[model samples]
Target chain A: MIGYLRDIEKSFPIKDIGKRRQRVLKGISFEIKKGEVLGLVGLNGQGKSTTIKIMLGLLRPDRGDVKIQGHKPGEIDTLRHIAYLPENPWFFDNLNAKEFLYFIANLRQIDKERLKQEVEEMIKRVGLSGNEKKVIRKYSKGMVQRLGLAQAFLGDADFIILDEPLSGLDPEGRKMAKDLIKGHKKKQKTVFFTSHILEDIEQMADRVLIMNRGRIIKEVHRADLYNKTLEQVFIETIEHDRNN
Target chain B: MIEIIKLTLKEAKREKGFYAGLILLFLSLICYFIVESFAMFEPEKVMAVYALSSVEGLSIILLFFLIFSFLSQDLNKKGIEYMLTLPIKRRDYILGRFFGINISVFILAIISTFIYMLLHLLMFGVCPFAFLIQLILLMALVLMLSSLPFLLITASKRPTLIAFLVFFIYVIGINLDDAVRFLSTRHGREIPVVSRALLKISYYIFPNFSFFDVKIPIAYKLSFSTMHIVFALLYGILYTFFILLFSIMLFQNKEIK
Candidate 1:
């Protein structure tokens, strides 16, 4: 397994001046095998991002075990193999695309000889070639999203965890991201991502996990999704769970 | 860790505060010169005092806010999430930020010291080596307190409250020895025992920033012992070390929500 989360539970303190806690994730468990493309789908505030955070050790789970590459989340060894792109993709606005990618590449410990060439290649690959010198603050939302994808795919990371990876992209940017995922799949890299776009998930994910109310309500494999589009199945499943 | 430091330096370069600080210092020095011109006796002496005070006070305030905003903005803007996810240890990240900011702090200190020296030469016609030593101590003072915001940001979510608390700590800390000395006099007996004890306890708990203030000695040309300088350096280094260790611990366990 490239990743695993067993019986994960998480909650955050209420924002108000109270001691109350609002549970965000309640017993979330899933595993992503090597070379598999797994997608997590849930409505807003359904704890999809929170689950990703727990797996990356950005946030601790109240209960459960999370392991990546047979190591606990956030361990140096585990993080060395994992590349995470957050849902909102906030980056230092002062650095230009090349500088920011170089920063990430340096952290990824890519070889000194190949660092420059690799950063340049990724810049062009993400369709940010002409604008590599422009600071990220000047980039449009779609451009920033593309830059986020560039950094995520840099340095040959083995397991890529992307939260809403395709959220802010335009059609061309979306195509670039889809092609990048396809390229990773061709290399037999494990990719786990979350998206609200069922069409994208249906096309990309080998297995899709449907999360709602902080729990996975359904799991559908590409081989099992017969005679119905993912949208129809998702709506039917949510409605069925609600009625029950 | 090196990458983080490099990133911080790049970010610091784009920050306008560094240039603004230099400009602010220059204007204040000019203002001091004008204000001291009205003094009928030892006008140059008065100018020197005010100029140095301006440098010290402005450097302290500017450095505090610069470092505070640097870290706090990263926290608020979610830039920290990008940082903490890297294949580096949290301790390395914290130390990298600390070191990067201190490098900027060092640059600012060196530039302001030169400015003060030039101002002193123009006003008094004799710039002693003590000015360099005294201002270096001022840098040490600010450096020691710079780690405080790191600790505060990790321990509390209330940025406004933390800002006030940092300022309050600076005020109380710098004036602590004076306050304690004044309290120990005849008027001190009027205060409650518990309150006085708490005050005495706080004197030990908080950083003794009063120890680093050498303005009066520099102003009056009074000699201070080398031992005093040595102890102050030791105190600043040790305090920063311990506080940063504590902050790293808190950060390692913190939930980045």
Candidate 2:
């Protein structure tokens, strides 16, 4: 690992007697330095969302620290440069796609002319051919994913976090998402995305983070993205966990 | 801050149905006042009572839609996800919502009360300037009261449950005379600290919709002291301010999970 790694500790307390926290993550430790498209891979309940939430400052870690650009996630001023998208997000209904983009752009205080051009380009890039007059409810899962992706790319923030972005997209939509990730990577924007679509990760991730039982099991490299599929590595990793 | 305010206004305005409903209620209030003006037996009393209660009632009804539009609209439409992704503070968003709803309520009331000015012209041929001022003041006072409890509901896990609890408590408080007599053994003598404090706060803080019930007496040329009106308005404002301050504090710690 070229980047620094901190000691992380995660455990479930005796809270919630019957339905305790799904302790899918355990002492996961890794470093994502600048300019990395870290793909997070895990089966269901693998602490993917929780880890992402901790990084986004949504959930505080029980015993660990994530230094993003040398600042903790909860640091509001530091977090201003980060963009996050949950697995399946909900958005305002009345806002047409363009209006919603404009709303976020205004919140981020991006330049008016630049925001106009960028949103238009994003709409076009996602193959969401429109003037943004269409309400978001009209969008399919693929379209909503694209719309959320457009939002993530807004403000041109330094770090972008997307969870399971390609979960419900068609082949074409997946291609678009892949292209979007590639663009973010090209701009040196550090991206941490999680997904069940192993093939998409094989295509775009510069490095992969595989987890099991609330722990960082392995870090796969993109240079080896073609050497063996993510599925192969995942099966091997899960088998290793089972044996040990 | 102004930008946030502007954004809040725009967000609330997008709910076309909500503003439409409030506008309709305001229009109805104006029409009712106009019709009541022609009914002349104890005309002053009728006008004053209608003026106070109808305005208060209509304001609440008009505001209900606005509040629902702000509170339920996001959950209904799932629109807040996009909002939360932004770097904006959550309290800023909540306060923006508060501002947007109150602003709409204020505007609607102003329009409705303005129409009442025409009744004075058609009936007595006077400007009704003084009545208009009182309506404006009443609108401000009620706006403050109506939104005061919003902090409680917003901070709670179940807004509907909290609303029911609030209603139940209010009902009990309004009927406290009977409630305490039945609940206690001897003359309902020594109240608990919590109950006493609650009673004191409710009597002083809540809008005291009954105070304005006296409007009919005042409007009918019955004698009343200016000090009472002054005290009532002050209590309403102070109550609203304290509650809003509490909301801000709670919101500061709120994590919208």
Lowest summed lDDT window (length 10), candidate 1 chain A: A10-19
Clashing residue pair totals per candidate (backbone < 3 A): 0, 8
Candidate 1 TM-score over all chains jointly? 0.95
Best by lDDT: 1
User: Per-candidate DockQ versus the true complex?
Assistant: 0.83, 0.43
**What are the per-residue Cα lDDT tens digits for candidate 2 across A72-119?**
665556567788776777666666888878877776778987988988
lDDT for each residue of candidate 1 in B1-257, tens digit (9 for 90 to 100): 77778877787777777777778877886787678768788765676677667767777756766676676667777777777788889988888888777777677677767777776777678875566776778877877778887799787776666777878888888889987997779988788999899899999988889888787787778889999999998999899899999999998888887
| A21-46: candidate 1 lDDT, tens digit per residue | 99999898888899988999878889
Q: Candidate 1 docking: what grade?
A: high
Compare the candidates by TM-score and give the number of the best one.
Answer: 1
Candidate 2 per-residue lDDT over residues B77-111, each given as its tens digit: 43443454467666675666667667866666666
Each prediction's whole-model lDDT (CA): 0.84, 0.67
Provide the lowest-lDDT 10-residue window in model 2 chain B. B73-82
Clashing residue pairs in candidate 2 are A24-A213, A24-A214, A25-A214, A26-A214, A26-A215, A91-B78, A91-B79, A92-B79
Give the TM-score of chain A, superposed on the true chain A, for all candidates in the order listed.
Answer: 0.97, 0.90
> C-alpha displacement of B54 in model 1, angstroms?
2.7
